[model samples]
Target: MSGELLLVGSIPLDTPEDVFRTFGEPLGKYLFAMPDGEVGPRRHWISRVHYQVLAAHPELEVVQRPAPDENGVERQQPRNAADAWWFKVRDGIDRVRFGDPGWRLGYARDAVNSYFVFRTMKEKGVLPSHLRFQVSIPMVNSVLPPRIFPNRKDIDKVRPGYEAATRAEIAKIVEKIPASELAIQWDCSTELQDAYGAIAGYPLEGAIERNLIEVRNLSPHVPREVALGYHFCFGTLGGWPRFAPDDLGQAVKLANAFVAASGRPVDWIHIPVLDRSDDLFYAPLRELQPQGARVYLGAVHNMPRFEKRLATARKYLPDFGLGAYCGFGREPTSELPNILNDHLRAAQIAAL
Candidate 1:
């Protein structure tokens, strides 16, 4: 069977409608569904969501610290310095408490708006009839405490409120949007951290099993009727992977772990294949047993070696869809069309 196309959330576009109109065909032709392209300021995804959450609760205070480089070198810079906003988070145990958190949480409202746009585009013939609206969410474990709280005690104190608020936000979405047209993807960049045994204070002894439990807990909330999927990520900054894998072994193992634990039918699972990936990088996929969940490999990139990468990927596991390593929101706006074009080209090559 030919592989379908999957968009791992954001597309750098002016609006959701534009994303549908511009790439809908190349997408509709090969994709099973379409995301709203995470248009507007939300192109920053987690950061934007964090701002919204902080804005609603005046109790929380934005705390800043020196920015740490990939090498752990602390750089003294302006709070608003390049990529410095990611490290700022509201820190206060009392303020972190969610008192009957409501619609003000942001994510549900965004998903609802995106779904309306999707429905409109579908009615106007921009999106295909069968296209389900994709709602991508960064897991609370990956977002809160980790990004916001550096102190382990602070993480323990704050995580409950943040998690409750997140669930409330999702509950709001489920209340509004029809389950049949919704697909919830829990983006897992921290899973890579778990795989590498690098999650600081978090014990890696049972990290894989712990990650599986998180997925299982979140998956059940989606309702068996709705589509639930996992995107095993390696972090992304400026459209580039944060960590290059030595092999897909860790990702493959986690994918299988999730499949075995998630009880509900996972409509799909996306795995990233970086620019430098070769057969060795993909060989571990031979152990990937998704049971029956569709696999979408993040094998698309802006390179002439597209066919070569796809061919190497096929050698280990031939049936899978196409996607970028992560969202293209951080990339130049001008690169959007070219990225779509690359998807089309990669899709063609995969068919051969």
Candidate 2:
């Protein structure tokens, strides 16, 4: 009996149709829900979309552009400081108000569009009838990151509007898609980074509490019938992991906070696992209080250490789903097959 499998949103496939045929068709049996692969612009994660949203705000101005890379090419919307275009409140503007005229975050639009394909594929039997269409959305802090906003005051000014926009997006999604056919996973990278103190100038004090407040705010927007999950991430913007923590202590603590703060029942939680196989690293998981939500450990990568990591993780969490540390969107398209294979193989190993 294989354990459950979770796909962390982005897939490297070119289109929703391809993702459905490729990932959904094969992995459908192992998965409770599936994403549209977050193709095209979303393949780079939320950065590209966020850049567009922030750049369009009338009160925001580009204060600094990313320096050119070694290849002498400067990315217009880089994910990190090294490649990101920094923004600030425009001169004479005391407050930054996003979505003033109306902000289009695009998650709802994309999810609704992709859902059509998902429904079509299921009808055609290319996907399992039981699989819900998963929409992976970035948390507010992730979209308006400290790296891009820099100033905590600017973040404060922009948060309400962005959050309102997010809630509206969720409203549209729930209205268009049936609750039973949908699952929403809030991706948390910046929040975790702040909690870990990895992001410079981002205060660690009360970081977990702040993140919990976000969970409380957004999780309620997702109707109780629509499956809700949280993806605790370290980010793969600049690399596989923008920051590697000493252990799972902070991640577990943060996960616990999110679960407790969520106003509604959480269907699942995805916690990324580093490549460490040591007991000390996995021990923190023992303290994870998941309530009634299913837990998925992202211990699929770093194959050579897979067994050790799984064995250690099992000692603390005897029953949990398996997933990659992050999405496959940033990986080379050529690696998709192997990545899929790895998930399947990891499931088999977990069953043993």
Candidate 3:
């Protein structure tokens, strides 16, 4: 069977028009959905918006600033500590309450604006009419990560307000876009990191449960008619493959938990595949129970590794879509064509 393609969000293009012309135009046939490349500030993912939100909060303070490297140059923000800022609950503030942080997250506004370009492209016959305009939103914990908050207590205190704001963002997006033409993907990088015991100063105990709680809370906000999906990410904040587990056991367990906890029908689930193809690594996929949701494996990075990974994955999954481990927004613009080519090649291989 010819497997479908999943663009895990951001396409690294300059504009929605550019993304529709360059990415959606050529790959629309293979793609079930595509994003506007998360152009402008969103190219940095949640950090750009999160920083603005956190910075404006009275109870929070920027405690750490990017330190100069050995070369005396500050690194780019959000990629690593070089260009990032850390926040903490103000010393005098006994409790942190972001009561209506009084700003928009920019997701809903961007999605509505980009959808215009998406629809235009489709009308021009540049993109397939069946393609849904994907809108990827980070889980609250992902946006306010332990790395940024550095305090679990502070995150607990701040999460409710942030989550409420996130839900509102979803509400706005759904209100404006037709459910059938929209797909909402909740990016779960930080949750997966915590589940893997990868986050510092955070206990791994109940991490999966915590993630499920958040999933249950956020999933219902997405209208039943709107396609809902979860992108189970290991993260790419500092670098790719943030957590290289010996096997897919933990990921599979987490995926199962997410599917079970989500109140509505999850249209799809995306799990990142490592570069290695060891049977031991992909073995836990045998335990996956998607519950009717389409499964997409992130197995399109290295062609050679992809072939081997796909072979191993097929032993258990049998059938699934293909995608990169995460979005291409962080990559240089020059590399997008190659990334697009990789997806095309993987699709061809999957068909074979």
Candidate 2 per-residue C-alpha lDDT over 1-352 given as tens digits, one digit per residue, 9 for 90 to 100: 3229999989988899999998888889899899999998888876666557777778887777667677988665464656676778766777555452222888888898999999999999999888999999989888778777656578777788778888888898999999999999999888888889887875788888877766778887789999999998988877878888988999989988888888899999999999998888899999999998999998989888899999999999988998998898788899988998998898788778
- Quick one: best TM-score, which candidate? 2
Question: Model 3 has how many clashing residue pairs?
Answer: 0
Per-residue lDDT of 1-352 in model 1, one digit per residue for the tens? 2237788888888888888888775578677667788787667666665555653455555565446877988543323323433333344334366765546556787789888888998898877788778888887667663645434455555566767777777788888889888888888887766776766677867878867656666667778777888887777644356667688888898888888888788889999887754778889989999888899998888568777788788889977888888888777888876887788777777777
Comparison by lDDT, 1 against 2, better one: 2
lDDT for position 156 in model 1: 55
TM-score of each: 0.87, 0.95, 0.93
Candidate 3 per-residue lDDT, tens place, 33-108, comes to 8888888878878777656677777888887766667798854355473457788887766655544422367788
Q: Could you tell me the lDDT of residue 233 within candidate 1?
A: 79
Pick by lDDT: which candidate is best? 2
Q: Candidate 3's error at 320, in angstroms?
A: 0.5
TM-score, structure 2 vs. true: 0.95
Instruction: Write the number of the candidate with greater TM-score, choosing between 2 and 3.
Output: 2
For candidate 2, which ten residues in a row score worst on lDDT? 94-103
> Over the full model, what C-alpha lDDT does candidate 3 score relative to the true structure?
0.82
Q: Of models 1 and 3, which has the larger TM-score? A: 3
lDDT of 2 at 314: 90
